[model samples]
Target chain A: MNEAAASLVADDGVPLKLKLRRAERAHKLKSVAMIAPLFLFLLLSFVLPIGTLMYRSVDNPELHRALPQTVAALAGWDTQALPDEPVFAALVRDLRKAQEESTLGLASRRLNYEISGFSSLLTKLVRKLPPEGAGVRDAVIAVDERWGQLTYWRAIARAGTPLTSFYLLKAVDHRVNEAGDIESVPANEAAYVTVFGRTFWIALIVTLWALALGFPVAYLLATLPSGPSNLLMILVLLPFWTSLLVRTAAWIVLLQSGGILNGAMIGLGLIAEPLQLVFNRFGVYVAMVHILLPFMILPLYSVMKGISPAYVRAAVSLGAHPFLAFWRVYVPQTIAGVAAGCLLVFILAIGYYITPALVGGPDDQMVSYFVAFFTNRTINWGMASALGTLLLIATLVLYAVYGKLASSDANKARR
Target chain B: MQPYATPIERVWFYAFRVICGLVLLYLVLPILVIVPLSFNSSSFLTYPLSGFSMRWYEEFFGSHEWMMALKNSLIVAPSATVLATCFGTLAAVGLTRGEFPGKALVMAILISPMVVPIVIVAVGLYFFFADIGLLNTYAGLILAHAALGVPFVIITVTATLQGYNTNLSRAAASLGAPPLTVFFKVVLPLILPGVVSGALFAFATSFDEVVVTLFLASPTQRTLPQQMFGGIRENISPTIACVATIMIVLSVLMLLTMEWLRRRNEKLRGAG
Candidate 1:
């Protein structure tokens, strides 16, 4: 040991540890070189884009950019009352400039998200600007009654900053009020909170339905011999591999009012009239459950396959009822799979867009539907980013929980 | 499992099997219904078929729009599959074989595209691509699709690498074989099944994807699912059923190939 320690020093008098590290550095660099191309690709394609979208949730630069002079003039005036004549004059100047630059719609549409009437109000004021010598405040107030209200000025002042929480607040159906406090919007104007609630409620119901239906099949697959189980496993996997759009299309064919289910029931004399099935909540739930059932089953079957049947037999030999024995001895062992599957199904369902959009009615749309609506239909990128951020957060949380559950299961098995 | 079973146990067993059978039927019924309906003479997607006909399939083949979308999908899916397989296989090898700091964080970031909601991804890519003038272009759509497909490739390839023996590569290196030759001759042959399956998954993902394409693609660049989405939204006809039936057959084939590859992988490992 003494000779080895003495020989550890190199001929040049460097220590062995540092020499080893210098040698190991090449291997480390090679590994990093292998991973760097993909890392850079994903960073450019995936991570940066999501970062840009999240930034849009707080981005309120258009209003500030278009109304620079108005924002500057309003800075000194307390928002306690209506803005003075100079502020109104500055607004007139910005409006005329914005109109000439073909940016009036963009500026006003941004403010319109804050207050309901600002869109038309700004457009109307732009269209009906008084003759060259006229007073700006009266001209604006005369164009629209909303310009006389303090609430409109407050929303504008709040949105004057480069970054604002207006869209995020509105995403949860809340808004900044005249008194500069956060509060809920009027009951009728409130839409997002209800949609979010419906998204979660539908997701929960679908998760439950998948669990209910998947449990029996998973149990059957676990208990059966290898041959039949493998065949049945293919049935589950085939649906899992099938195109999502195809499955949704199938549901539409079979569940529409004049479709197969109704026709079959009428043929069998179960009902005289065709039932309203598709284009409603029922259709959404039915299709979502069908699409997500495989997600529920695969985890559950793997877990159940690991559980020994001797435990149930031991319970039954102890004079417990058979159902009680199975439930008490076997079911608890599958809870990890249940948690993983339910969380996965719920996460996927809440963000579902294609199924509900095809099969659902007006009232059946979820939060993701609104996200798409604002993105494509209305071009309200702020609201879309805000809603998308919220959904992303919820999904990430649930996914973290699933990760823990899955890892712990793996750890337990290894032990 | 059937040790001294009571009548209640027997009933429960049969009932459970029946429920499982029904559930399986539910899983398969949707894909099955589209096949016959696509051939129906009537345009409606309902029962009581007028007669068997191939008009819808003809229409699908004849239409410029559908053919264009099909062409676009074929182009995008294969390109995305190849890109994803290359990047994902390299990263999986690096991760499994190399010791590194922050390895877990790297894996998490690589797989996160699969976890994040597609709508979020679509919206993000729309805004980002629009800023860079990549929107409405095939390059943008293919990049986005490739990003989405990478996670599947990484997952499968990493799983395959778990059973791989590292000493074989070391032995080859000691014998004066170059690194590339060792990889092609020893490691690649062993992991080829995993790579192929992963590529299959990437292809299927790109083929079935609609949301990102909707955000990124122009009307001229629409893929099959985007076309189907528009068709389903604007009109309901047996033409969509025809397209859907074709997709079902494709999925079945893909599933069988995956199963076959998995069995081959297991056999190779057992023999080795």
Candidate 2:
């Protein structure tokens, strides 16, 4: 080793490269320590819990432990036939085992939460079964009169697996039949499918309404002097900074029958009586659009501010009408901003819970309302987690599609 | 300030300007109305007040629950701001200066909090926090708020770092200063605008966040927004209007301070 390297090195005569390697190792250790806190925070707070919540979607403990014999016996039974005497006896055996194990109560509560009255059905049937005997079928049939029916057998067959597809199917308005194939629920019973549709419809309407209100203001912000523009922007952002609950509450007072809007209308002699505004879809839309309008304007204003004034001037000088020039030249450039703002607003509107729940009629409630219903009111985490997963997947897919469209447009712009 | 314009064009501009000014007034009317109504002697939250008084504000300030929520918020907001600023600055620095692989993925993950719907995030956090016994604790609430606040900090800091010059740090390093010392003495002072802006954004975001707080906080740890939420649900108090007025004033003051800081930073950057 050279003199300088030797001076830096240990008395063991380690090579210069080895010493450098050791120093690198020490540096990496220090870097890892620097990043450890953030990584640990994410793991403990975000990653682990999401992992567990997602897992609960398929966690079917009751089905696994309670009906083992019936599940095993059903493997041999003909799909077309009602379960025979042996299969019925096998079910009785399973119910007795489940009762003796004392774990079926939790399962019944969970199932009952999903489709009300399942707990009583399962409990009565389980209680009627003898400790061990041939008369078990007669006893269970006495408890649930529908026990011998094919529909009851089908429901049992549906719940046979520990790894359940139940929650996922319910999320999409389908479930397993007796033959173990997916089928839609009765048209009248289907709720979530319509709720998802309503979510998108409300989102689309809210996006359009916000755009209509925000576009003119954004134009002003772009055209005005810096002082006026900044002042106007603060007004726009003031509502955004305030608590959403406070703002929505204010809307309630403003929109209620005897509230400010009606009081003003009455005083001005515009209407004969107080109008029903709160607790309706109209109120929900008005409040949501008011709250979300800033999201649309901010991006649009920023984009408009960046466009050179000369381009519009250039169009005017070239025999193009002002409106035509504005639409053809100015609007196209702001497409990126419009797209971003629409996507942002639409995604937010779909997941709206507080505003809709507070102001809207029962029919105006969206998929997220049901997600919360399962989460809090019913305490059905499985269904809630499944619904959440469906929404997440839908959001991811929408983003992917948006990313594709954005890149394709960018490519065209380059060309 | 006068640029050449045709009479028709000038007319069009003024028409649009008046329409926009009206819209801005409409937007601010509710808040402006509430401030006066908060001082109304009458219990109702309506205009044409029954003489000026601050009884509602007095009532809000007197309540132990409201004061406790304000106290909790005072503790949580700054803690969240500090945590978010630190992690956000680290992530922003790592993304901007380091040529590591998967940089784009990491950056996307950092910014995803901004795009994701607060409802979904809150639901996810609710279940997640419950499992670890963090559902009601101040530490849990602060961490959740910090996580939510990080995106704003990242966006502001990244923008600031983009304007920063790396050559100053390189020069300091070449002059026998350690990398850490070079970062502190040279780089940080230069990008202090970004850091300050990021910290301000973090604080504002925490102060405003409600959905996650609704889900994650316990009765004892209830925030101001949560308290307002309960008031909206259970009572018809003009006190909520007072609370709203106070929050608006606080936010405006904070924003003005930040704007001042931003202007000073811009002037300093130009001079440097």
Candidate 3:
């Protein structure tokens, strides 16, 4: 060894710094290179957008800015009784200023888009602003007529903020009562808890449907000769080659009232009239199962393919019935595949929005529908974010439970 | 250990075979119907062939919107493929070969795109891109599509690398070759097939994605699937059949290419 190498090395000839530095550099480079694309992608698409979406929850500029005078006046008021004249005078001043600056229209439009009746309230209040600002609170109350009502006071008090918790509260089936205290919404108007329940139920139904249809086909493919089995496997995978849109659309076309399914049933004389299949729960289930069946079959079939025939043969030789042998020996081996397929289908089904939107009845809509509703219609980012956060939590919990089950199953197998 | 060939067993076996065949046929029927309908001379999208012609294909080529969407998809899919392939291959190697704390958590984060609802991802991206003034730009779409594509590439490539040997790289490193040099010259050629297949998967994924594209892009920048979505919403157009037909053809070609590469890769691995 060279003198420098010998000096750097231990008596056993370890080149400490060079080896460590080289290893360090390699490891760092590998990690950076490996993770860079994912980081860039998430940063641009996933992270940035999610950040913006979450930020939109507290975003209140048009309202707070236009009504700054009114908001500032009402900031520290006690909630024991209705507001006094000064708060009304602040509203009149803010409304007049807002009208002059053309900011009132934008603020009211934004609010109306969120909750529906705010436009007329703002418009009427602005138009009837007294020549000398007299009866400011009563005049403000006179515009909507609801302003004098206790409910109106409650709404104003609830929404009386530069930043409102209204959307977030509504997302979880709770809201600020007239007293400005948070409470559960009435059972009739409570939407989210039921929506979440429906989401879980629909996903469960779809998972079971796919498994029911897929297991037999998967077993047949597993038992077939290699040549035919491979071809069949490709056939099973064929639907995946088409766009998901096309598959969903095809189902719509086939299931509609005047569509092929109705035509077929009528021709067969099985029904006197066409069934109302499309735009209903039955259509949603059918479409989801068709789309997700291949996912179930492919994994289950692959797992089943790896099982040795000898195990079943040995079981039969030991005097087990064929049915028992198939169940005890063959079926146990497919647990991994079944787990994977169920997990895959269930997760995909839970996130489904399009098929359900197109085919499901109004009540059949999942939690994602409301998430979109808040975003597109209400423009209520806080509610949308809260809903999304809830969904994320549910998904993570499901995954954790799945992981625990899978690991315990693995442990049981080892035992 | 064959079962007794009783009449009931034989009958049940035949019934099972017939049912399975019918299911397979059912699965492929809609896809198979698209090509024939694409050739329908009649403008209506129905079977029984009013006539046979290439008019739909001609129309697809003639229309500016269809062609523009096609152009957008062509541009976006390749860029996404390149991005996904690089990152996915790197991740596959690191995940399989490298040791680190929180490795499982990192891997989960990397694959979470696949698990999360597309609507959530899309709306989140919509708000995000709007915030950054990138809502309609090619850079935004490419990055969004690439993020969606990465999970598939990572999944396929990692599966491919599962059985690969680590000793060869260690041996090359022990002979005084730099790690980078060894990687490019030795490791790359060995894993090139996995890398290529991953790219194919990435390409297919981005090309087929619709939800995120819809929310993140405008009419002028809409992808083909988004275009088809608009067409379906706006009116009943036979051109949708032509579009679906073309997508099917391209996907079949791509699937064939991947399968061929897989076979060739196996042969090459065997020879090596």
Candidate 4:
């Protein structure tokens, strides 16, 4: 014991624990060194950009920059009434400078998001600003009556700050009322909530469909002999390997009103008339289910493969009916796989854009379609970022659930 | 196979198999239908045997727009694949070898590109690239694509690394080999199959990606999938079928190579 104690001390009189900790620190440093390059790259390329986009969701800097003097003059004015003449003078100054620089278009567009007619109002006023010495307030009001309204001035003042929740509120079909309370927009104007609901509803139905179709196939693949099962596995893997656009295109060829499926049905005399299949909800569901089936089957198959046949055989021999035996003994064992597959399909379906955009009718489009519309067509980055943020949150929540389920399953395995 | 089964059990078993058969057909039929339709002589996309021809394939190869898109795809996919493979393999190695705080957070950040919707990524990247003057540039597209492809590489390579024996590297280190030397000589060869598979995945991802390209690519930088999207939206031509068929063939080849590599990896590990 005394010799062991002596060995615990290093030759230079340092303790062994300290020496070991130093070595451990060096190892950790080396690992950090190895990871640093990719870490920095992802930070620059992925994380930073997404962060910047999220910032854009609430970023309202254009009006602040373009109408700086007007923003300052409106700082302490009561929002219940129209601003005084100083605010109007500030507006004239900002507008004259903006017109000189030909930058009135940008500020006007930013203000247009707050009120409908502000864009035309600002553009026209900039074109017909009266002489510099006149009373700028009445002159501005004369150029456009919108300038005399409290709501328009309120919008300008609200937008003058560096950040605002206008876009984010608009994303969920809510708005800040003139009383500064959050309330829903008119029912006809509420688009995003319905789109989000449709996205989830379709994703849920697709997940259920995939589960229904995948379970039987996974069972067969798990139970069948190696040679045949492997062959069948390739059939599942082939579609999984194909290009997504190609697969979606194939669906178009098959499901079009004059396409092969209708042709075959007519030829077989099953129906006298062709059916409307493509460019609708039916087509969207069919295409999504076909595309996501492999995701479901693969997970279930892996889990089923690990389950021994002895459990079901024992259940059968114990006087249970065959169906009951299979369900009671076999199905419960594959819950982990079921959860994994369903979560994957559901998450993927909710974010799906291409299939729905191509195959579905106008009303059937998902939230992502609108996100893209705002981005590509309207160039409304704020609205697009807000919608994207909501989608991101939904995805992260589902992923967290999956992570929890997976960890619990692992814990169960350990037990 | 169980002798204990009742008479009804056999019926249930056959019924299950039939259902499975139909599911398999559902999965494979769409992909196979595109192949013969591509060769159909009729300009229409439907069946009824309008004879056979190679006109669509000829047109695909001859059209300047299609050819240019193809050339861009070829260039962009390979470049993105190389970049993703290098960074991903390095990250995978570090993650598997290291014991560090906040590892899970790092991993989540790295894989976030995969979890986030492509529309979001495309929009985010569009705004970012526009701000930095990378809009419509090859460098911008490649960087965005590589970011998208990195998660696949990380997943595949990390999976491969899980089966690797770290003792081999330690033994090399014990034999006076430097860390880099040990990595190159002992570690890389064993993981080459995984890295190659990851590269293939990265390539396929970049090749298939259209949303980001739609947002970022100018007219001159259009890709094949971008062109296909436009065609599908505006016109239903047989030429798209030809393109889809070619893509399927390429995917099949890639799948075969991946299967072979997987078997080879298993064999190598077993031999070791």
- Please give, for every candidate in the order listed, the TM-score of chain B alone compared with the true chain B: 0.97, 0.93, 0.94, 0.97
Q: Candidate 1 on A1-415: residue-level lDDT in tens?
A: 8568656977788977678778789878878888899999999889999998899999988877899999988887788879988888888888888888887677787787777678887877888986434477887888888889888888788888888888899899898777778999889989888888999999999999999999999989999899999899999999899999889888888988888999999999999999999999999999999999999999899889999989988998898988898788899989988998899899888889888999999999998888889999999899999999899989988887777777788898899
Off by over 4 Å in 1: A1-16, A81-86, A127-149, B1-3
TM-scores, one per candidate: 0.95, 0.88, 0.88, 0.96
What is the two-chain DockQ of model 4?
0.76
Model 3 shows how many backbone clashes?
0
Q: Is the docking of candidate 2 incorrect, acceptable, medium or high quality?
A: acceptable
Q: What is the lDDT of residue A181 in candidate 1?
A: 84
Candidate 4, residues B106-138, lDDT tens digits: the string is: 887788777788888888888888888888999
Which candidate tops lDDT?
A: 1
Q: Which of 3 and 4 is the better model by lDDT? A: 4
Give lDDT per model, in order.
0.89, 0.78, 0.77, 0.89
Alpha-carbon error at A289 in model 4, in Å?
1.2
Name the 10 consecutive residues with the lowest summed lDDT in model 1 chain A.
A130-139
- DockQ of all candidate complexes: 0.79, 0.44, 0.54, 0.76
Error of 3 at A55 (Å): 4.5
Model 2's DockQ?
0.44
Tens-place lDDT per residue, model 2, B171-249, is 8888999988987898788788788888877887788777788888888888887788778877657898899888888
Q: In candidate 3 chain A, what residue range of length 10 has the lowest lDDT sum?
A: A151-160
* lDDT over C-alpha atoms for residue B50 of model 3: 92
Which residue ranges in model 3 land beyond 4 Å of their true spot? Answer: A1-33, A55-62, A84-86, A105-119, A130-154, A160-165, A180-182, A186-194, A265-273, A360-364, A402-415, B1-3, B174-177, B234-236, B269-272
